[model samples]
Target: MNNHVAPRAAGKQVFITGAAGGLGAAMARMFARHGAKVFLTDIDADAVTAVADEINRELSDTVAWAATQDVRDEAAWIERLDQAAKAMGGLSVLVNNAGIGSLGSVEQIELKEWRRVMSINVESILLGCKHALPYLREAQPASIVNISSLAAFKVDPDYAAYNTSKAAVAMLTKSVAMDCTRQKIDVRCNSVHPAFVRTGIVAPFYDALGEEEATRKLTRGIPMRRLGEPDDVAYAVLYLASDESRYVTAAELVVDGGACAI
Candidate 1:
């Protein structure tokens, strides 16, 4: 199935973080198919390169480049952005989507794990915005789509660390948006909060619950009556990254299937 959408990307360049996993890889391919030069990075070296190779193989001139780097490293952000910009010819989009998840009540979660979750979830977005802003400003009329979570808005036991991290992400997007406007950077920043998606984070848990339980019980809580797919979030990213959302910033687009509405 081809996931490309022409006129949506308009051949702009997009740099995506966490480009190896389900949602990240899907977004990379979708943007490439839409005629954008896509550059991606992940801590998983092999996975990042694999996606880049696949995209380059399919879309030769589209320019797909990947790097292995930790999102928490501030210096690495500049290095990767420079590399990606050099490879893709320019930088027009930044998707601050690299994050890790955890499931534990506040008291039960270890200090190390809590810190790690926050570092990956919150620090990554901050660093991505900090390092990518100058380039985005130069590119002019660029967009940034940050990945938050429904946990930021809803109650979920055993997810205190994750929830807190995402809450920070939500506000970070708004803060960046304000900074852009105040500084007249000509860049738009937005955040997306999605409910349970069928990604690695929840797949194993669903499997342990069996198909019937997974679908009938876990997903029954979702107003949409189903778990969100990576593509569901990818499309949201595409919209925010495109000129279609040019005037839209400092906004949070909850792609949680109305889970937060209830």
Candidate 2:
């Protein structure tokens, strides 16, 4: 993790979903370290609270708060955003980072699984962007960073549902961005597409094939020859959530280490 602290996000109030672990946890830490007040949420109540406590302990300040949330629930989105905005004075950044991965080819995948993937990965983003707009607008110069995936661009036969959901995220981000711009809202919307990173989401690969072999297999196509660290993607998100990318909206920031270049 980067130790250098910068006030890039000072005074920014950020709400992040799926912040119990992996990329979401990394993002929460990154934002808090840089002076942003973060409200972290996840379905995992215990884990999410632990993460918040850890961040506060590290910073020795009350810059992070924790809550349990089911991103798929529209009611939860409405209530949580309100609570967060009230707690932090206002909501300046919404990181739609809650998502899930699926396996099975098109014909082999079950309808229920497909629906599950769509609801959590795609619909949740819609709910978040739609409901958070008011708070974000009130806190002008806000940003919505949707965490997409390199899978949206690169296909895998067994990842039918996962691929489709992420692709939807990419386009949905653009739609939201355009709407906000046309209406002269100061909220910026963008997507971050990160390739495989060393996170809990990819733990299955490591468990099946030893870490060394899994690393080799996963990095074979990446030019960097290594799986990306959570901070790698977290940094990209920080840039978009901060004032640095004020003019950058409706853009796809790819952090795949040249995977898409091939």
TM-score of each: 0.95, 0.97
Model 2 C-alpha RMSD vs. true structure (Å) is 1.8
lDDT of 2 by residue, 1-262 (tens): 3557558899999999999999999999999988899999999999999999999999998888999999999999999999998888899999999999999999999999999999999999999999999999999999999999999999999999999999999999999999999999999999999999999878989999998999999999899889999999999999999999999999999999899999
Best by lDDT: 2
For model 1, how big is the CA root-mean-square deviation? 2.1
lDDT by residue (96-189, candidate 1, tens digit) is 9899889899789999999999899998899999999988998988999999988898867789999899999999999999999999877999
Q: List per-prediction Cα lDDT, in the order shown.
A: 0.89, 0.96
Give me the runs in candidate 1 sitting further than 4 Å from their true place: 1-6
Off by over 4 Å in 2: 1-6
Best by TM-score: 2
Candidate 1: residue 114 lDDT (0-100): 93
Per-candidate clashes come to: 0, 0
